[model samples]
Target: MNFNFLSPVSDSVLAHNELLSAQVLGRKLHIHSKQNGIPDLDGVSIAILGVLENRNDVNYIGEEFELNEIRKSFYALFPGSWNTIIADLGDINKGESVEDTYFALKETISVLVKKNIIPVILGGTQDLTYANYRAYDTLMPMVNLVNVDCKFDLGDSQKPIKNNSFVGKIILEEPYNLFNYATIGYQTYFNSQEEIDLMNKLYFEAYRLGQVSKDITIVEPVLRDANIVSVDLSSVKGAEVSLKQKYSPNGIDGKEICAIARYAGISNKVSSFGIYEYNPSKDDELTSMLVAQMIWYFVEGVNCRVKDDDFSNEDYYQKFITLVDEQELIFYKSLKTGRWWIEIPFLSEVNNKLKRHTLLPCMHQDYIDACNSNVPERWYKAFQKNCL
Candidate 1:
């Protein structure tokens, strides 16, 4: 509860919210303000944290205040069937160094997540993802991260931490809690051959930008099994963001990224999410609105969550078994949501974290492929990672 690092929301932003109607989000939000102090989180399920730290970014390098633009748009929107309470925890300013900022963030994240209040962070740099990953160290024995980015971001682990190299640090760092790392919308040209080979060698998952664009729903299965979802705003096209400094020409479109955000929200396992690399100076009305909608969609998904983990209860799941290459594969389809999950056999001798949850979210096609004597790459990868 020691949120001393958090600064109160600006009077100007609060003034804007005052003008809105009672039905608007601005009125419903429990904002941390100078007059009212940090809002009570008795029933809040989601907290919006604006992180203003970017000294380590490799691109658009500068220090300035953020969150006003994004909050202006996010607060103006109308809520849609959401019963979950949201709090604007204001912003966490940069510290003496990047490590200091990380310490503040890690502590803040740990506090919110332990209370089961998911933190939807609007961040300074994508490298803050390293801090986000570290926040979950004591909360969960293992973690599954899904990053929506144009590049794999597996920069040299030996090098210092930067926007492009945070993922490498997470992989090589101590208390290796990262169980699985998946990259969605990675453009091949943006990543080097060495990093790509390393991703394969380590059994990490990477989905090409084309593969996601071709069938965006395929990402749902990947996200459904994830515990942490981090997005790099630079993955958005330059045209959509209306900023040339960080946006790329070829990447996830605005609508697709919002859809992915919703998918992440719907996952019962996903506890933390951050949209990083947002440049407030370069942002326009459209840019803020896009980010705001992504947040809205995520909140909506959280409200629609249903607990379908009890596969032992026959009434909730349709169990199916298939054989491929003389190996048996079991799949469970939720009768309520039609979501599919494959069973990874329990190994008592293996790490307890890997055995904590045996079900891995997968697609219907994976089961069909198994029936056709073809291995689902998704299952194969998880199997390899766990067995190793």
Candidate 2:
């Protein structure tokens, strides 16, 4: 309820919104403006927030940016045939220090999540993701994060918390609530060997750029089990984004990124979503439009969500059992959605962190792999983490 840290949307954007057609999203959303303070949250399913903090960027040189352009692009777009209500709660300006900014972000997102309202954050730097993770500390026992990035971002925890190193802080910091961390579209050259080794040792998931581009559906299961989904714009290809925002020549394309966003939206567990590392520029129209499309696809997916994971009703899902290496694997296929899940046996005797994560979302291929006598990698990793 304490959103004093938020600033109203810019006057220019509001003026532009007035010129847009009534059918666009600008007219549909309940917006925060100078004239109308904060909008009522009653029946609001999604809230859009912007955070203006990037002092922690490793390549920072005292440059500042704004989210007005992204807002304009998002507002001008047409909405899908959806039933969810959205509100733009405006932006959070930079605080006295980076930690102060993080605190404000944490508090704001915490309030939204507690109300069962998903926050769609447009951010300055990806390090804000650490604050996003912290927002869940009191809400959930353990958290699963799905980061769509080109790097592992597991910098030295002893060093200062830079945008590239915040993940390490999340893992090392007190009140460890992180249950699992996964990275999608990771470029091998961008990550050091030690970070890759550490990821393997930690039993965290990492999907290469080529792996995801080859088949985007691989990320669906990973996202299905996620509680927070954070995306870094730098993971997008140089040709697909603005000059200032591009970081790689080979990365996820605009279409693929939008597909990933839609998958994130469809997941029942994903409560908070963020797209970060935005660098506004004069020639950022293309990037802004792509970001808008990504948001649109996410909203579309959210409207299509189905409650197909309930196993209490025997007729809702069909169960299958297979054995590989003398180990029994149980798989369930949703009769409503055709999605699959593999069961992770509860280790009641051992101190288990995954007592609540018994059903692991998986693909049909995983069932085929188990039928061929090969243990699915996702199931193996989850089982290993549970035993740890």
Candidate 3:
């Protein structure tokens, strides 16, 4: 019930040489600045907790990655109105139990909710989602949980909290009927026929990866009704969540994943959000960059959806037609970093006139780059000139 962060983490510990520094998009509230928490940002508060350890990946020195650089990565990804506050869980050993982590997260979430700010949990593992939900349980008797993961994560084995058993623990511990939970993007390799049978028996709503690819729009209704969203970065194919568990060479590309994140963020019912399993140790430069991009798109989705006016286009009511006529407007299929980009003319004026705020242009660039792969630059230039 009472809120406290694991005491004032010693200045030296919090301020290590590797802790990189980058300006966040919104107001920055260092926990040391105000113990009572920022009173003003009750509606939308942001917190980034680096739970950067696991039973399997124990050798990893969680803090080696510069915090400021990581922050900068986020800055480059999600550009606007981010009330950023960050903390690190350090290397939580097997002795350092999930319950304690849950306590810390609960206290933090309590404070943010009291102040009306949205709380985001960056994960150490998928198991953290259970801790997040446990924290949620302390506040409300019932809250919907949407798990966007590549696996069903429900196995009969009573193994230590590892890669695939997180959802199983939740379902068994907390009766499925009591909570509205849906599993999306479940791949074949992750689940067994028995597991699938159990899920069907339990009447759990599920969408396989093929189904997701068929039409991502159906995910809209699932998210729209959920109270909390747990997004496993592994669910995304190209994500750099784990070196050992990496799904690279094949996975959902960056852009669609961003769109999914955006939808979850804008889900009005979504009070809490989480992105898990970011094993930076295995990640390359591009991996963090992609994570950053996804974060940006999520924020943009929230901003766009929550804003009073629609800004899909500059004019509120224009001749609504797909303008990509003869000239193919080059845009990437997925917004990856270092992709080609064409300037969109009249963008500033349109944004200003429409009263729309676009966050993290880097993400937009990723989108532009991906789509433009097929489309020509000259067409883009012409489109830009016409729009201007």
lDDT of 1 at 231: 93
lDDT of 3 by residue, 154-226 (tens): 7654776555677777766753323456787888777788888876655556778887877776576567557
Estimate candidate 1's RMSD in Å. 1.5
* Over 4 Å off, model 2: none
Better of 2 and 3 by TM-score: 2
Tens digit of per-residue lDDT, candidate 2, span 1-388: 8999999999999999999999999999999998989999999988999999999999999999999989899999999899999999999999999999999999999999999899999999999999999999999989999999999889999999998999999999989898899999999999999999999999999999999999999999999999999999999999999878888799999999999999999999999999999998889898898888888888887888899999999999999999999899999999999999999998889898865548999999999999999999999999998888
lDDT of each: 0.89, 0.94, 0.54
In angstroms, the error of model 2 at 115 is 0.9
Among residues 3 or more apart in sequence or in different chains, the pairs in candidate 2 whose N, CA or C atoms overlap within 3 Å are: none
Model 3 clash tally, residue pairs: 22
| Model 1 accuracy (lDDT, Cα) | 0.89
Q: TM-score for each prediction?
A: 0.97, 0.99, 0.63
Q: Candidate 3: which stretches are off by over 4 Å?
A: 1-44, 56-69, 77-95, 157-160, 174-177, 239-245, 306-388
TM-score of 3: 0.63
Clashes of each: 0, 0, 22
